[model samples]
Target: MDDTANDDLDVAAFTTAIEDFNRFYIRLPTLEKLPFTTLSVLDTLAYGDGPMRLTDLARTEQITQPGVTQLVTRLEREGLVERRPDPGDGRVVLVHITEAGRRICRSRHADRTGHLIPLVARLAPEERQAIAEALPALTRLAELGRDRGRAAR
Candidate 1:
């Protein structure tokens, strides 16, 4: 805990955790060869609870359908994903992670389970509550930032 910045916010802990996460994720050997766009699409699905339609995912990622299509194609070729027809709507295809994709998700997820979750778990009850309460506002800020950035671009 020496030299730990005890600023108004637990900025050091948060920033260190973020930096460590980025460092580990970027260093993963498999990721070295992955296209950022392709990995982003897979990450969107992995971060969520389930598969998504290309259009829906693309919208969430602020990318185009053709970009999603290309990423999906590459992932499919890599055996990391599969395209399935929506049961109720055959015209709409849902992109799902295959076993390999699940494996990748699990491995990548394991990396976070060690660092971020443990530190978060160490927070006092009230502190955790504060974070929970702040989540919505933070999310709104992030959304606004994204929207503004998009508009600016």
Candidate 2:
């Protein structure tokens, strides 16, 4: 085939594969049970080194500042988070995850792993090997994207 035809085929194949992977991943029992936004916010807080500012949370979550505040309020009401004044800046309220939040996060992570492990085990050996070989590059791609996202904000 000509170079143009080859390029078009490559692009289509790449796009389809990404979409398929996302579809399969989001359909997993663990993810399907949680609201995407709640999981996103909880995951962010669980992974962060410390409390985050409301504005930063909004930016990270790609939502409005008020939206994040509202979400935080709801989380606080549910005992999943607590807001405290930043020692460095009394005016800045930092959102921190509560013990309940941490517990839920650990539970969710375990659930996802438990659900995925069986699926991975069921895959043919060759298919599992192929995925393991691709993992490093895929992980690198995710890291690059995360870096770019941080830089953008």
Candidate 3:
């Protein structure tokens, strides 16, 4: 195939693989333990620096400000999150994950790893090696997407 043809094929394959992964990843039985939305917010908070402003959380989750407030309220009531005054601005309150939230997030991560480890272990050595090698690129792809989101905002 010509260089252009090969490039087109590569793009098609990459896009399809990403689409399939996105569609199938959340459907894993281990991940279904909590409502996806709840887990999503928790995971976001877990990965963020300290407390996050409510507005920032809404933007990050692609939800309305009020919607995020409701979600945060629910999480807070569940003892998964807490509201704190942003030290820099008393008017600006930030949402932070509680210790319970950290524990839950860690448990969920471990569950996910446990689920995937056996599956990966079953793969051929070369296939497993390929996935291991792809990890850094996949992480970079995620970072690029996040950077694009910040730029858009």
Candidate 4:
């Protein structure tokens, strides 16, 4: 094959591998009580700069405004998140993750890491090293994907 054909094949293979990995990862069991959407909202709130408005959360999470509103209400009732009036805009309400929410997020992260460690350890030394070397590129890829998603929305 010509160089261009080889590169195209490599890109296709990489995309398929990433998609497969994501599918497998999503199927892994966890002790989480919250639905995936709720957990995702908490994760964003926990890691974000500060509280975010409902509209912002909806945009960032790629969900409908009504969906986000319902999720936030549930989270607030569970004491995982609280809404407060935005200081800059009285008409706007911002959602902030509570300490309980942060704890849940941390526990979920630990559980995921625990589940992955054994699988990663099963890899050959060279394969593990290759993954480690690819971390930066993978991170950049994730950032680009996130940016593209936002732009598309």
- TM-score: which is higher, 3 or 4? 3
lDDT of 1 at 4: 50
Q: lDDT for each of the candidates?
A: 0.74, 0.82, 0.84, 0.86
Ordering by lDDT? 4, 3, 2, 1
How big is the positional error of residue 29 in model 3, measured in Å on the Cα after superposition? Answer: 2.1
RMSD for each of the candidates = 8.3, 4.0, 3.3, 3.4
Q: Give a tens-digit lDDT track for model 2, residues 1-153.
A: 333676544756666898998887656676335577877888788885458888888988999988898889999998989999999999999999989888878887787788889889999999999999989978898788767767766
TM-score-sorted candidate list, best first: 3, 4, 2, 1
Superposed by TM-score, candidate 1 places the C-alpha of residue 9 at a distance from the truth, in angstroms, of 11
Q: Could you tell me the TM-score of candidate 2? A: 0.79
TM-scores for every predicted model: 0.55, 0.79, 0.86, 0.83
List residue ranges in candidate 1 displaced over 4 A: 1-33, 113-153
Question: Which portions of model 3 miss their true places by more than 4 Å?
Answer: 1-9
TM-score computed on alpha carbons, candidate 4: 0.83
Query: Candidate 1 — worst ten consecutive residues by lDDT sum?
Result: 25-34
lDDT of 4 by residue, 14-83 (tens): 8799899989886677778668899889988997556988988998888999999999999999999999
What does candidate 4 score in Cα RMSD to the true structure? 3.4
Error of 4 at 117 (Å): 1.1
Residues forming the 10-long window of minimal summed lDDT in candidate 2 = 1-10
Return the number of clashes found in candidate 2.
0
Predicted structure 3: lDDT: 0.84
